[model samples]
Target chain A: MKKYLSIIVVSLFVLSSGIAFAYDGSLIDDTSYTGTITKIDRGARVIELTTKFEKTPKTWKLNMQDECQIQVMTTKDPSERGAFKKFAELKEGTLVNVYGWPKDGKWLARKISILNPDDYMVKRLEADAKAGVFFGHEP
Target chain B: MNKKGFLALILAVLFLAGTAEARKTEITPADQRDWQVIAPQDSDTPLRDYAMLYEAGGHDGNIGVIGIPSMKPYRYIKMGVDMHNFPFSGSNAGNNNGTPDGKYLWVSDKGADAVIELNLQTGFAERILANPKPFGIHHSAAMSPNGKYIFLTGELSGKMAKMRVADGATTVIDVPPAPSAPDYPDASKDGKYVFSGNYYHSAVMVFSQDPFKFIKEIPVGKNPHGTNFLPTNRWAVVCDKLSATQSVIDVRQLKVHRVIPVGAGPLHNQPDNFGKYNYISSFVSDSTCKVDLGRMQMVDEFPIHYRVGHNSIAPDNHYYVSQNKFSTGLFNPTGIVFAINFEEQDIDELSPTYGKTVKIVPINGEPHEGRQIFSTTIQRWNTGTGGDLFAKGYELGDVKVNFDEKVPGKGLTKRPSLEPIHLAAAKRYFIPRDDGKPGVTQEGDVTVVRVKAFSYGYIPRFIHVKKGAKVRIILTNIDKAAGLTKNPDVTMGFLPAGYYGQKTRLDGVRGMSAVGEFVADMAGEFEFYCQQFCGPLHLEMRGTFFVDPPGGTASLSVGDYDEISKLEYQVSDPSEREFITGGNRLLNTLKEGNEPAL
Candidate 1:
């Protein structure tokens, strides 16, 4: 009976260790994503955002981790940059910039920053207009 | 009869027979013979009534003449000048623009940095107006309607000059720096304004002809390669190379009025003598688009089998002749000439045989700028004082005669020898591909096959042969005629790494055939396709050439073939994918947005 119990314990420990190793591997090769937040699920610690890439709009879902750093830009001054903030402060309809690594079909966020939504949205619209003209389409 | 009487009669018969034979073999001096004179005829007579055609040899630096309708072999007239000798002279001889007086032909000598005037009758260069600047590449010449002033564009210097014909005085006018190379120059019918097309800039630089002053720069499409003005419509049509559109500018307003889309790589624009239709030839599309000036719309688009450089319309307005420049990939030089019959109201009414084309190799190289030498222009030279100058031992060669009787085959035909390909080692070749891997063949024998290329596709798309075999590919262009009369402009290219010594074998034009012989020194699957931009579906015109091992059954299956049998010829639009990417900044900007502060 003791042998079987030891076997079960070792198996659970090995499986958990594998899961940890995979999570650690996912932390490597970090990239960045910038977009407007479309949805936020606090319970799941997940945020869905729409980003424009190559004049093509794409949606990405990111998971917030415990060590993820957050910052917010509240001033319009070009030199002021941004100040540190909390992940809980992020909300839907807010413009966000994220840095993370992708693994197991999920984006693991390591850093998040909040931007001036109105300014970024206007810039995005202007870009879309220019793209439309280049593609022979009326915006 | 008595022995003496019989001998006398026999001697008389023999003498008569020998006299007849001598007359038959007598050779006539080319200059002494009076063939069809280029003298002016009745204006009411159609241009097709003329018996000859004149073409400018682009690299060859000679003017070639051939029989019209008969489509005979070319007879070359060497442009000999003392200032410019044969070995070191005649670099980049561009378009032949006729002088208003018809006594001389003006051509830009790019290498000599001079504009040369060739006397029409003597075939001798009468004057060489050297460019003051040493590095200027003289490209095109335009004569003032009054016939007193000659205008020329220095393509490399981005400058235009007006020269007085009487005294050879030159006044140079500086214009905006042409980022795109400046090519052809055209003058208004009134001779008030001259326009130069910037090949890379997609703009036309306008100037006052008399004073040689820059007036304005008018923007058109991407890569405006050719420009021509229509006095009847008071419009100038600019052929945009990359944009696949023709920008029509109001000559009076000096502004673009409308842009009509055309085939890809439109290189030259030639308006018919009547000013009813404007024809544009596309380099990449292998087709010619005819724009009806009356309706201001594209009426017809027809294939020319290869990239056409410069075109000339017959004065009688029965047909127009266009010369081929390069193969589809712009890698190989093509010396094919197309004679398109425009008099037929419908394509169906045109003859596929006699009315199509003749293949003639240029004297020095491929023919480029072509201009129709009207009978009126020739007559003026012959009857006027110009004839006296020509009579002084200036005429060079004779016009080619007996075209129908001397040459065989109709439409597109093969040359007697494949000398062009044998001279230049191919840069691309064909290898085999099998099961997503390089095909391996064990065979050591040579394999020979014939391939027929058509619009957007090739016959026997999948070819199976052994490795290390001497392979001979006989290529025939069997593409259907565009509409009822025009031959499909198409060329076949074979591609494989390290095959044919890294050379590409591309030959055959519409209605013509070429043979490619190579030792199948390597084994593998290679891809073959139409090398020239045949039409919109050109990308889909491809096939597989499988080289299998002697004992291997590694043949391409139906599932393995990328079948494009259903594709047809189409005009390709400019791709805007790069613009959509926002000039290589979108990806960087997106990444920068996620960068840590500062």
Candidate 2:
């Protein structure tokens, strides 16, 4: 009975340690996922995201870090970022790419890049359609 | 007593009548006549005796004669006889240079490829000699000092011809082929030799005045474009466009004696009346350099706002008039003439501050080569050589242009209806988005986009819309300067096809805006670009206009639409996943390596 209890306690300790190490803010091994921001909570410094990769479109909670980097990416112009901002700046319907570690069934955000904050994607899509590339034909 | 007195009165009346008849028959010999007294007065003079006339034509194909006073300080009067049958139609006036004889003015007509002699009184042109081949582009004409022959330089043919004034017989001499872009031809004071500058050859070709014989090719500097002979100084100054040097050749020896450095792209050099200083005009630097003949060095330089072309000093030596050729761009062919005051008695004379005293005269047309119309020979026809009269003002009427009033495309029925678009220009960029949002995506709505044209490129270089959509584009120029310190004038041109023609153009002045409207009716990809030579990378400033078919539903996504997979799709290719993962690793490594060592 003592040996069995000791084994179970050891196993639990190892699993918790693995979970904590995954969210230790090691950006080198961080996972990247692109999604749309569905909701934001300035009080809790958290955001609700929906990704195209998942069926049923579950709203996943993502926690922000004190050093989290938020950037705006441009197609040809240089990417602009590095200014300090609050969680309120990230609005709903904003397309973003999140880079962080998964912890406790949620993502701990290391960086979030706004891919089309100016809605350039809409223009680009229109251009593609005019070029017939969206319809899989040559213009 | 009454009979005797009547007889005496009759004899007295007969004697008076005989004396009057004798005075009427008295004639002066041609050799002893005071020809200067018969010379025409300066056009600017309130009271003038004779009128000096030459053929004047505009770029819009209007040809006529302009008359001015033959005396100093010449001014323009009304247009003289009009030439209804003048040949050749182009942007230039076709008449490049003109020389006035006592009764007729000989003009080198580049467009007609012929030498036309115009009757000064009637203003009608008659072909004195015609080129066997077309497009000779005759540049300048120099009359022999003895007035026996007129030497003309054929710019395109690289040949020089001596046409006999009396018989209209021409003797052509072909210079060596490589450097044969000959420009100005000037004769020696003794009328023994003629010298022409071979523009591409960087040399001066000498020919005998009488027979048009190629005497020798005297090498000078790179791209010798202009040659002028200063009779008082006995020196021939040749301006080299490429080397920025003046080859001062000794006329007696027919060789270059010294090379004096001048401003960049020194094109034409003219001497003051006393030959004290030679004024050199540079095309690339937009400045004029004054070279002291006695010192054989550049003594002073003055900035002329536009590119300096041919220049001439006033006969009184008080000031000089220079022609300015603006840069080649859309709707910028017309240039201005500037009179720079160089009065030596002024307190700020010949100093840099003296440029403030300059006067600008606006002119309609492209005026390049010009000269003051006063000549001792021309004055000799009026009175004796010692008469107190000097010819002053130039006849730039030989090169004039009237702006074409017709819009680029007036009768095209297939023209598209253009809406209004606005653009903003920055240094090296043209931002097309006005509201800080992406371009319009809707198909049926009016497409109004604004764009800014500046130094390097246009922002949002790509645009798309449905076919038959009306497009309006407004452009602004915000570039501080074009090159080092020159202000920029931007021109935006569009081409539905691949060639340049009657397309839409939006021209904007510095800190100003211009508007253009067109229809994106063509269902294809077209390019719009800067029309002017704005900067080094001006050709690369272009944007795409994409027109799609109606009713096609295109997905609007941040990334590539085709690459985006469905929600249920899983990563099937392991190599694809590896490539993406590896690319990110490489990017992180590079980003870390590029960081400064703190």
Candidate 3:
């Protein structure tokens, strides 16, 4: 009984302290941008996207390298890393979060995580309806 | 009294106190302003036809705002010559560059040895950024792609300066080969490098903007004048005036990739939006050549009237305006010298008049260059976030800079610091029924005069003072373009009260009051006017300074056409005047040939 109680206390303490030891799926970066791809220049290996979280919307052209990591998220979390992908699989209108820094006058991409559609507001509203959270308002 | 009645009286007292406190913090009907966001306009809108043209030459430096398509004159904004220490020498205003968002325009006043930043929304000359030591003659400037830095070129000083846009923190480097003159500069689209054309060394000097260091100088043809990078950020094409060819520097390799023959004296060049065609203005040949960028060769040429100096494509890529020099036979001849003309050529394939001179607008003074801006790019009002720290409402009527302390013996005398409340009350003096007082006050030996500047006029239409009195005129601008009207009858209308404040320090902070101090020496009836184009009544915003004579007697002098009529006049013969007018008409009728003329 004493051992069980001690284990329960430790578990509560760890959870209360907010140290979960789980990956949030965000990459380390000098600068980061999460936006939908508007254009893809194959010859230059550059993709243009309007920045998501900025007071003033700005178009950023990021250069993709061969060694850069490209992943597609599977979970509802927008930043969750899931499966590996190639540059050819990337398409316009796909939402992505990029981690990069300026290199040789170009924004060189270090990592690009293609966000899951369910993480966005529209898909989340539908998920909430399936869960019957909205009651009579659910469509 | 009963216990219940006494308790009710106490409750009533507490309720009254709470009501009094609530009224103190209540939002006034005027203060209850909710802002609405305006959607960005399309770049192809016809409202983007406004062009800003500048002349830094003989006839007094001024910026002319002209209309396109119709080719009509609107108004000219006088670049503050009477306000600053550098009185805008009518001969040395150089190149200008606007920010990516078009909120502010940076113009180089070489005569003042400073780079002036103008707030586009209010048309106010906001800040004067002085070139650092060892560098003089601030010639040209280019804004970075991200709008964070301004790359400045010094022609006579043989130096290049990089100024951070947020604060005017500057770093200077020599344009290598010791005596090279950096005439014109252009920042790369990727914001990595600044390419400057060196006239003396005949090379285009490249500098890394991040570390602010000289990278390399690629040898080009003789007299490299204007350097412009294509949209691809791969090639920087430089017009070599003396060699009559363009040196295309491959930015990826940092080498001169091709030297294509363009024409006689190619002075300036600009590439189209698609990076498909490049236009090079040939000064000696009186034509502009269009080069195919992919082929790296001159494909077509369009003849402009005479001496094509600078050329620029419109924002929508609908047409190109060729700034031609030496008016000659284009306009009505005034004297031995004539005025310049801005000739517009249609480039839009959808338009009926493609590759033709659609209109010609004659203008006074010698204009060096012109830039076209879409109205949507400029902010409706400056919020102090768009790199203009000295914008109105950012600093409320307080001048923290001491000009006399920085550069002593200059006209502005020393000013004592005042409290924030004193600065706030300075504007209230102009408004009656607010317990306000007159502006002019005597402080010790100096007479302090406060001038309240707003949209249409300045307070105190006339200032009367004794001769030799030390006068300090502190001009405070209280109007802001941030609020809406309270009338329910009118919708979507904003208050017309935006103006850029002057008096920015060298470090570019804490300039709220546009202050100037001078001894009233030998002053009769000197006139002071609002230089910025505030509104329709901007010309009416003028005031006179009346200084009394030595005997302390105020007097006035009036003059009329009678004085002019007494002077001898030289009249041209009627036949000579008729011939000149007929010649101008014939040239206008004959210059409209269908040949591709830009």
Candidate topping DockQ: 3
Q: Residue B480, candidate 1: how far off, in angstroms? A: 28
Task: Indicate the worst ten consecutive residues by lDDT in candidate 1 chain B.
Answer: B85-94
**Model 3: share of native contacts present?**
0.00
**Per-residue alpha-carbon lDDT of model 2 for B459-510, expressed as tens digits?**
5577666666776555666576665326343333322211101124454455
Q: Taking the tens digit of each residue's C-alpha lDDT, what string does model 3 give over B1-598? A: 7999999999999999999999997876535542121332111234434433333331223456566544566665554221111111110101122222333556664433445555454565444444443244445677664445667776655678776543455666677778777877877755567888877778888887676779888899987887987654557789988788998887767999889999887877766543446788887677878876656789778788766667766533456778776455667866433566778787644344556777777875445556654333334344545333222212111111111212111123212111101011112111221212437888999987666665555577667777778876666554552112111110010111101012110010012444455565543443445433233223234555566666654322422112222211111223212111111112112221221110
- lDDT at B311 for candidate 1? 66
- Candidate 1 C-alpha RMSD relative to the actual structure: 33.1
Clashes (backbone N, CA, C under 3 Å), per candidate, total 31, 35, 0
Question: What lDDT score is found at residue B28 in candidate 3?
Answer: 62
| Runs with alpha carbons beyond 4 Å of true place in candidate 1 | A1-139, B1-51, B80-101, B177-180, B327-364, B376-598
- How do the residues B328-408 of candidate 1 rate in per-residue lDDT, one tens digit apiece? 333344345323221111121122322233332232344556665333224334455643432332211111111011111
**Positional deviation of B492 in candidate 3, in angstroms?**
51
TM-score of each: 0.43, 0.40, 0.48
Runs in model 2 with CA error above 4 Å?
Answer: A1-139, B1-102, B119-128, B177-179, B327-356, B374-598
